[model samples]
Target: MAFFPSLNLVARRLGMYRSGGKGAWLFLPTSSLARSRPGRLRPFHAAFSTSAGAQHSEEENIDHESSLGRAGISAFKRAVLARHSTKAFDAKREIADETLAAILALTLRCPTSFNVQPYTVTIVQSEDMKQKLAACMLGPNSARVLQAPVTAVFAADLDPVQLVPRVQSLERRKRGLPEAYLATLPFSVAFLAGKGHLAHAFKDLFTTAMSPLQPMPSVSTLEAWSYKNTAIAASWYMLSCSVHGLDTCPMEGFDGRRIMHELHIPASRYAIPLVVSTGFAMPLPSSSPERNEEAKKSPRFPPEAVVFKDQYGHAYKGISQL
Candidate 1:
């Protein structure tokens, strides 16, 4: 699930220090980065082009060999580089069941906090069901939903704390760990949930007091935590679809309540975070300016602009020297 095998390569190229001994973190170079110069860094702009349309200039094209110095691109890199938020899909094109299964299998491997896997994906393929779901969508998204062959509703469990013990116990049992390790599961869930207002107040007080001494996660409702985890899975799902030669459009402009009701998803138990429409992208017509414009990739800020090193405001040394 480690997306970037290049990280360890980068670490070694930068002569990063690692603890030496058994059971210690090892920073080993990969075959891909073996040909890359130790001190040399590729220009961020030259590394990869964000422009997706065919109309981009030669300079705007991605220099994969120069950037990665690898004979072939990794599947992870290929997926990340190729993925774009598709606005229109070819209604005639449908994803095969096997391909869809593979995409879902990869998506499910995405990591979650404490391995709770708090999200649920509802796949809608029926024409009638797609129309019903599209009715809940707002703006142009409704049209997009109707166009795609499949739409996945990503929902987060409203009461994810209740799932913690069940998931943890199952995981422990599978690993042949002692059952006694889960003795504090109930107490832990209660502490995390902070059920009543009084309990919430106490929990907030404890977090506030402890934060000054050590780092603590910002105090938030269980719903917020669930959404955070669910978003991760949704992102992975999009990339997985892209890897399978499919395109996805993630839509947040939907009536969550209506979607839940239509799908028979209990609002008390789950909340819709977002929905993604997946299918082959519609081919652009030569004379269609709107389609061509939509195909163009939006500009992105350079790594040096957004990424920081040891402290905020300090540029990351590696990217800055590129």
Candidate 2:
């Protein structure tokens, strides 16, 4: 019997028992895939069929090895980080759907303030939608977004922290996290998430469906809040992709109002945060030795220079100096 690397990866790496904790199958490593170029292999799954009589510890041993082989447990992450965005993508070939989905899944898992993940993402696949987004692409990015196989928009809800009380209301119930955890933090989360919603939806939700007597924050505050929060989420998405191996172009040069009008997204309900162009890079002049020699060899601060001891001015005189 033949097995695909993806399936083999899952089969061998997973616990035979379906509910065996981490043994459970989770498809699409979004962060990893987002970092991947279009043609690059997105090994989302690995197959490992367990021995019917194998001991549990042996299974653990296998998992340990699997971790080590994750992208070869590579030491080249820094090199990947130094890579710049490509202005061109080979759009003739399409990025696999699963791969794209995986990329998005990472956004879902991305850290949010108090874990209040409040971002709306739209994937532009149709030619017309891509056309609509073209103006959103900046200078060199404009050409790339038009030619790329897929363009994704990352939009966030502001004041997402407003949703914290509700989140705590729900989260505290699960695993019994005390409702007090919310207060211990410097800021309120439910307030943020709720604020995000208000920024994005309150005006419309009130005008179209409210009691007609409800008070609300001014339109400008809500708008500003939504734009601010969504941009943060979008930035996180970009950095996460950057560390993994994907190239992302964060575009702000387009007409947000036109995008809202064309996409049918109510201006009151959502604001366009960023149009991210994803795929393999088309090799930059910067990648060449002549262009990058200086940047690549740029000096890095000594560990001691940055790592300050307990006090701000306390210099580390020696080891255990931490």
Top model number, lDDT = 1
Per residue, candidate 1 scores C-alpha lDDT tens digits across 49-98 of 11211125445566755754453467676777678888799999998999
Each candidate: RMSD: 15.9, 19.7
lDDT of 1: 0.70
Look at candidate 1 and give me any clashing residue pairs: none
Write model 2 residue lDDT over 221-294, tens digit each, in one string. 44454566567667656655555556666676777778777777666656676788876655556547735535
lDDT of 1 at 322: 18
TM-score to true structure, per model: 0.72, 0.52
Evaluate all candidate structures by whole-model CA lDDT and list the values in order.
0.70, 0.52
